[model samples]
Target chain A: MKRHLLAVSTAALLAACASAPVVEHSKMTGAEIAQIDAVLKRDFRAKGQAKMTRLEPDAVQRECNLHADNPPDSVARSLQEAQLKTIKYPSDSLLGDWKNGRKIAESGRGMQWNEKPANPGGGGCYNCHQLSPQQTSHGTLGPSLKGFGKTRGYGPDMQRYAYGKIYNAKAYSACSHMPRFGHSGSLSEQQIKDLVAYLLDPKSPVNQ
Target chain B: MLVSGRSVLLTAALTLAAGSAAAQSQFEKYQKMVAEGSPVELFELVGEGLWKKPQGPKNASLEQCDLGLGAGVLQGAYARLPRYFRDVDRVMDLETRMLHCMMTLQGRSLEEATKRLFGNADKPSEMEYLSAYVAGQSRGHAMAPGQSHPREQAAYELGRKLYFYRTGLWDFSCASCHGEEGKRIRMSELPVLYKPEAARPLIATWPAYRVSNSTFKTMQWRINNCFRQMRTPEPVFGSEVVNAMNMFLTVTAQGEPYRGPGTKR
Candidate 1:
């Protein structure tokens, strides 16, 4: 019965495509993108923290949009270099308490329009990545960081990398789907440090 | 034709074999069980009552209201909607058309009609109940949203553009999650909306009863929530931008049977 349905659908799709005069393309032209942006600007209303400025694409975002998140090596390198300059590491420590970091990772409360601007927002790390083995409800969009410090040695370099990546993920990978938590002002330097510790501290559940 | 037929059979067999090998998780099995015995009928009954009830300032019911099927005609009306309406001189989805009725026929202000469009699990809105009832009426009908009209075509184009237009904090578009085939986010398989096969089943099941939230959802609410998560500003309800997106999805999945007010995770 399922096969029959599939065959019927396949035939119908072919027929529709053949008959329809519409020109469907995967890539959008510059003018089309601009038009869409205009339409969005007109249709969307800024409610609280969600201002119209959020629609404005940054340089990295523009490149990612143009290339469909698959920019050429040279383009990616240049963009990443520019993005890397945006990250501001703390003058002192790059690691903080992992316990606080665990709470930050679990909470997906930041940057939404409904959220209060005064309250400290969460890192929302667990939304996309599997951080600790005990959390069965974590998302799988990102790579698993279980036993992160155990697998990759708990060194200063690893700590720095984690802090930098959490601070500005696009700085490392030009078109990464992960949000620039620190760059976007969604996470503070201290919060990022805590996240770094959550990933790199041997005592942290992520490393355990 | 013969080769294509044989290939289809082979593909179906492989899909079945794969499906059996990777058995459904306990959670999915439970969801399926719950879905099989859903109480959506109660919502439909409530919706039917609302449809006939007279409570607006005009002291009239929605009986005379046209759903692009002439006045008071309900059969197979939803199947051919998101189409051009001459009275409004615009293309409208079901919710938009219903809103228009509330304003014109029922003598309600735009603010009053749209003041509480979305509802929670404790109390479903009139729109949710009405959508459930209306959509249920067209259950066996084929999905045939407007595409031939110039406005509809334009809406479809805009929706297509919006689908791939990536921007914002996460640098995500609808395509970011839904553009690819055979990809999933945290065990939930994302459907490639532009592709006909993947889009058909997804579109056929809308105004769905989401088990996760214990709430019935409309296509308008679905689009609004997506933008919210996309880190973009909130879209106005019954806006052209949303209608266009709905047109795109509906037209893409045209010809699939309407089997909704469906259950969802």
Candidate 2:
């Protein structure tokens, strides 16, 4: 095993060196990134609920984009800390009604230009997660949250973690594929709390 | 064509179903089933008629419209698309080229041509039918998009950046969903389109007939719809960004055999 590891490391080192030129050529310059952003702004038109503001990247987004979603550990830690400060946790219990949470998870509706701005958006959880055991057509993007409560224990700490994650996934993991539901104002505080309950409540189908 | 298609599908179906050990294989079976029942040829046939029929102010058929090979020559043309057109001085994919033909050859106003660009199942668009027919002709050719031209090179670069440039309410660049391998959204396995392994098969089979919506879709419409789901502003049809993005994917899948105008679930 030791010999095999050494061999693999040597091969990897050689491969990395060999591909250095290609990597250098592929890296986008700040000016080029700006130009691409300009092209997008010019080519795309604001329609319905999707305004031109959507094109503008936040600090976390700019950093993530610059680094191709893999910023340096120190940068990521600072950004994540900033993101964590954005979450508005409820004064009371983090958990809400699990039934409502199930509905939110199953729904893939929300925030699209075609959708109504007045209507509250669905969590779209099932779009990238496996929550309930009965839902077999679940996505495999994120780690499966099946039996989340049972495995992790339905405790206050777990509930708080779930709420914070749902509200702003970037707070926990910078550049996560999951959307910042609450931070983006796509989901209400109550809705995120409901999603937390859906994940952590003992009676929830996800736990079962 | 129908008889041969049915027989081929029936044989394939018989050979399948024995390998249902995994979910991926199961999804493959479902895809196969959808592909087998697709009425893609019907759309192609309609497109052929539209291509020949005269309608605009000039009452001229698109038979004389050049698709890079020359006027009216369609064989393997789709394979070489999103190419730099000297006349337009821009990189145009199949739909953009067709739009150019509509204005230049047919004498149709841009508004009139673009008004019904995307259509529903009950009523398909001119662009959709045209895409199916034009793309079908390139079945055996290798996917070789224009890369030599400075404009083409620039477009590809822009598209590469756009693919990873995350923004919008959801903060989804194309890479957010499609970057990682083995990731899925609601049972649909997202393809990492930048990589040749995924880009080849997908690029070869675009301008596909979708079974779910019962509609013939062009690459232009496909990109536009993706932006809608991405929670971004609508991409203007046949715009530079859309063509550039298409160029990027096509260039990535370069040298892969063109095998579609395919069926999609």
Candidate 3:
């Protein structure tokens, strides 16, 4: 009688599973997000330059996480406007030397746990976008910036746009994959200006 | 007129062929060549020795340790791992199970067992060696990770959540790289782990020897390193979070043959 009952219960359990409703994948629940945060907090420990605070998501990050990096257009515009206000452009100029800019873009160092805090961080531009045709090896995550200045007019307005974009990419596209180099304090104002020149300067190899 | 038309068609075909050839990256070709002649066998041999050697306080070998299968059964054991053991009352991955054996049977402390989970290129860690040996034993056996049990199901669900849960400084998750199909970073191809087709091949060949790093890396090392790159804090060794992620991946790749301790670029 016990064996028969066990068999009947197992069959019922199987039936329940077979007819179970599939969960929607459109968005994660608040409770689910909280659980994930709790798990991360429990598992991860601070090491080197990477602190526990890094786990906390900013407003933009939280929105991106909720929407899978595809937030509604109205929401994105407001968030982007707020982000744009954060950029602090220099009064003097928006362009720097293209020669130094090439070096900054080439290097993929700094901000890692092993890296020294004193050392200036690299822009790591080559890791996502192609700049100069001479550099054969480059990542293809972002659109190629080869012949950028020559194609898109090398004017003061263009330079300002480039500077702003490099400073905080979220200002233009709220959920863009590009890192906010200047906003995150990974790249300095001078460093961002240099990257703008690298993209917009007539003399740069990228323009060549 | 017919001869002229045929020549025109041939010329167009040649041009298309040349265009496609130029599109293929040279780095990808080199990576394929390196993978073909990888020295994973050497690591497997080293791992076998470490598994048999007894050097803890109690001086006990791991041969008596049960890996989901019965005691001393190396064959087909790895394929059915990340399972719920009644004794532990939790779902444990292969690495966690080994850590348990080392502490219980070998009489080693938690700190001593986990002190050097990740080793340098100069010398591989004990966990790496054991993982390579154990994973190798399951070669040709089907991947059948524990999913039927209640605890195992819970672990898998947690892992699934973690895969998509984007946080940290970079706002990256495992899904940032592995979620998309046919996407790549530079020359390296990223596998979509949630999907069965992509997950199967990748899960089968892990606990691999990375050619780029010149070191044997287990799944634990892989998870830890990924977190490092994601700009997150270091995960605790043998942590529940790490094991859950493993369970999720292994269960996603269920039914494919275990053919790993593989070579990677």
Best by lDDT: 2
lDDT tens digits by residue: candidate 1, B188-231: 66788887787778878888888667788888999998888788
For residue A13, model 1's alpha carbon misses the true position, in angstroms, by 12
RMSD of each: 8.2, 8.6, 8.5
TM-score, every prediction = 0.87, 0.89, 0.86
Worst 10 residues of 2 chain B by lDDT: B12-21
lDDT of 3 by residue, B38-101 (tens): 6778888988888888979999888899998888899878988889999989989899999999
TM-score leaderboard ranking: 2, 1, 3
Task: Pull out the clashing pairs in model 1.
Answer: none
For model 3, what TM-score does chain A reach? Answer: 0.86
By lDDT, the better pick of 1 and 3 is: 1
Question: Please, what are the lDDT tens digits per residue for candidate 2 over residues B1-265?
Answer: 3345444544544444331247567557767777877889999999999999997999999999899999989988999888999998999999999999999998999999999999999999988898889999988777778888999999887787788888888888898788888888887779988887788899899989886687998898889888999999999988999998999888888777788989887
- Model 2: which docking level applies? acceptable
lDDT for residue A24 in candidate 3, whole number 0-100:
24
Better of 1 and 3 by TM-score: 1
Q: Per-residue CA lDDT of candidate 3, range A157-202, in tens?
A: 8988899888888899987777777887889988888888889889
Task: Please report the candidate that would top TM-score against the real structure.
Answer: 2
